[model samples]
Target: MDLGIAGKRAVVIGGSQALGLAVCERLAQEGVNLVVFARDAARLEEARAHIRRIREVRVDVVAGDITSEADVDRLAQVTSETGGAQILVLNTPRPPSPMRDFLDETDNERWRQAYENQLHGALLVLRKVTPLLIGPGWGRVVAITSASIKQPMPRHAVSTIFRAGVQAALKHLSMELAAHGVTVNSVAPATVITPTFRPPFHNVEERVRAVPLKRGGRPEELSALVAFLASDLAGFITGENIQLDGGQTRALY
Candidate 1:
């Protein structure tokens, strides 16, 4: 599949590892120049080096927290220096756990922290990158959200509430950006195996029991959908939240 994004510049937040890195790898294979951002400098560098070995695309790593406005501004600046970005893949600071009841067991401060990490971080990134997308008159912004937004996970109050807020923002932004040839959409996945965070599902059998498809998802499975969404083929798709949860949401609803 020719994603039709070769030579295009992209910014992947939290791209140092896990699902973010997997998306970068898929985009890099399509010849997209990447600016990968994360707070850990060593890990970011390692990811950059590793991607370089596998693909012949330009890759740069910026060390910073997505939750920080200063860092997001830096990312926008660096990406602008390369002529602005055409694809924005947002996969930022995830919740601590997918099955913890922060609302009942934790303090207000902890709940606030989770909200800041998920909602604020995404808003900051969008604010900083909107101009880049608007400038070109064509853009693809894909937010990597969680399936919990549709089907709430057990005891994951913080994520359930905050991630839904993110989705709402994206929904409106997609409409506002539609006329400009930019599409804003979200991909919500369930139990994707990633190094940065782990879901409570211990084994395949247990995980599959909840999903009608009877299995958890892999990083590559999620990335493939992201790749499609970021391409010209997905031009007419916007303001939509597609679930890649292997029928989990369907079964529940």
Candidate 2:
């Protein structure tokens, strides 16, 4: 099916590897022009090359952390280069430390940094890039979050808390932007075999014990949903926390 997004420009944050890279590749496959954002110059280039090989789409690389105001500001301008971006995929590959117990979270600075790295950072990008979409009256914002946003993970204190905050913001943004033809939503993905989850999933036996599917969710699985969400097919869906868990979560709502 044609997603009705051919030639549209998109910016995928932290899109150098794992789900981010996968999303970029899917967008390219759909004939969408992409600009991958990352803090590591090398990783961004690697993603750029990989996407170029996957399809003949214009893939630009932007190097910067999402947590920085200056970086987001720069990205906003970068979007203008491709006639203003129509899609934004906010992805953070490296989540903060897993502080299971309240006592483990000893420093206030740690909390501040955690929120800044994930929540505040993405919010800045949203602020800077909204104008590009509003002017054209069409846009897609898909946040790559974790399953903890719906079902709290034992050790993920900071990520769970802030991702829920982002989900709430996306809900509000959906309502605020609905009239303008912009959609705001999130994808709370399940377990994936990647460097990002190695630490959390160190105890492999313990981790998959609850997964009814008896397997881990792949990065591509999450990216496929993201690509759909960014496309016209998902036009009616917004303000939702769509889970990509492998039946790890049992909540029906």
Candidate 3:
């Protein structure tokens, strides 16, 4: 289906690899110009180059850690130079593995970092880009969150906690922003095969067993939803947390 988002510009955070890159590809296919943000210069370039090869849409790569306020300001400046973005794909950052126990609550530093990465960083992006979008009185902000928002995971306590907070905050922002002709929403994926952000399932078999489909989700599959949400067709949709988890999420809502 034609997404009807051609000639529009978008800002994609955490676009260095995996699901973020997949979203970039899908948007590019819709003829959307892109500014992909990441921390690693090398990986960011790689992603940009890959998208450039596949879709003719212009792709700009910016290297900066989103957790830092200064970096976010700098990134926002660079994004505005691209004539501003109407679509914002907010992908949550993956904290390090061997993560400290959330139940234990031993490491306050880790907990602080988690909050900053997931919530503060995401809000900064929204604050920066919302103005650009409001100019045209049309905006789409689709966040890549986790299914833990509904069902908590023991192994991913930190992510589950922080991601739930992110989703809650975004939902409130959605209602407030919708009046301005801007929509805010999130997409939650279960067992998606992204390199750094693996589902906390025990093993390959265990992960498959959790999903009714008996298989893991692929990056491209989730990206398809993001592309659709970022399009004009999804203008009426807001404050929703849509899931694509191979039937993994059990909750009906």
Candidate 4:
């Protein structure tokens, strides 16, 4: 199944490891050149080598936190140099560890940080990259969000709040950019196995029991959907938040 995106360039945020890296590998396999962005310099280098092994596509890495405008500016600069990217995958940041109850999370600062990390940071990336994509008259923007936005978990309130905001923004952008041949959509996953779920973050066994599939989703599984959304095949799909939760989320819509 040729995705018809070979030779196109992509900017993958949080592409250093786990689901993000999986997306990077999938895109590389499709013959897409990559600009892998994340905060870890060493891990980014490792991901670059790993993707290169998958195929001979150009894999560049930029180390910086998405919440920092300076870092995103640097990413935009790099992307501009080699021609604008046709695809933008914004992998939402990992939720804070030791998930807290809504009432127990009394620290206002924590809420602010959540907004900064998820919503504000997403806007920053979108602002810097959308223009690059707009002029091309062909673009794909896929935001990797959380299923929690649809089925809110008490312990994961912070993540749900900001990610929902990101979803709203994507919905609006879908129509705003439709005339430019750009599609904006989101993929929400829950109980997905990723490096971000290390100890102190989530209990894998406990969470899987709630999923009808009785298992956590694999990174590659989620990446496959992302690859589809970023391809020409998904051009008609926009303003939607598709869930890859293994029947975990019961929302009818």
> Which number leads on lDDT?
4
Per-residue lDDT of 176-213 in model 3, one digit per residue for the tens? 88888999988998888767544452366677678898
Clashes of each: 0, 0, 0, 0
Query: Would you give me the overall lDDT of model 2?
Result: 0.82
lDDT digits (tens) for residues 1-253 of candidate 1? 7778999988999888889999999999889999999999999999998888879799988898878899889989988887778999998577755346644745777677888889999999988886688866789999999888887877778777889989988988888888899999889988676664433524445666777776678899999999999998899999888898888785443
**Model 4 per-residue lDDT tens digits across residues 9-87:** 9999999999999999999999999999999899999999999999999998889998999999999999988777889
Instruction: List TM-scores for all candidates, in order.
Output: 0.93, 0.94, 0.94, 0.98
Score each candidate by Cα lDDT. Answer: 0.84, 0.82, 0.84, 0.91
Which parts of model 1 are misplaced by more than 4 Å? 197-205, 251-253
**All candidates in order of lDDT, best leading:** 4, 1, 3, 2
Steric clash pairs (candidate 4): none
Give a tens-digit lDDT track for model 2, residues 55-103: 9899888898889899889988877875778898888544566555555
lDDT of 3 at 139: 89
The ten-residue window of minimal lDDT in model 3 covers 196-205
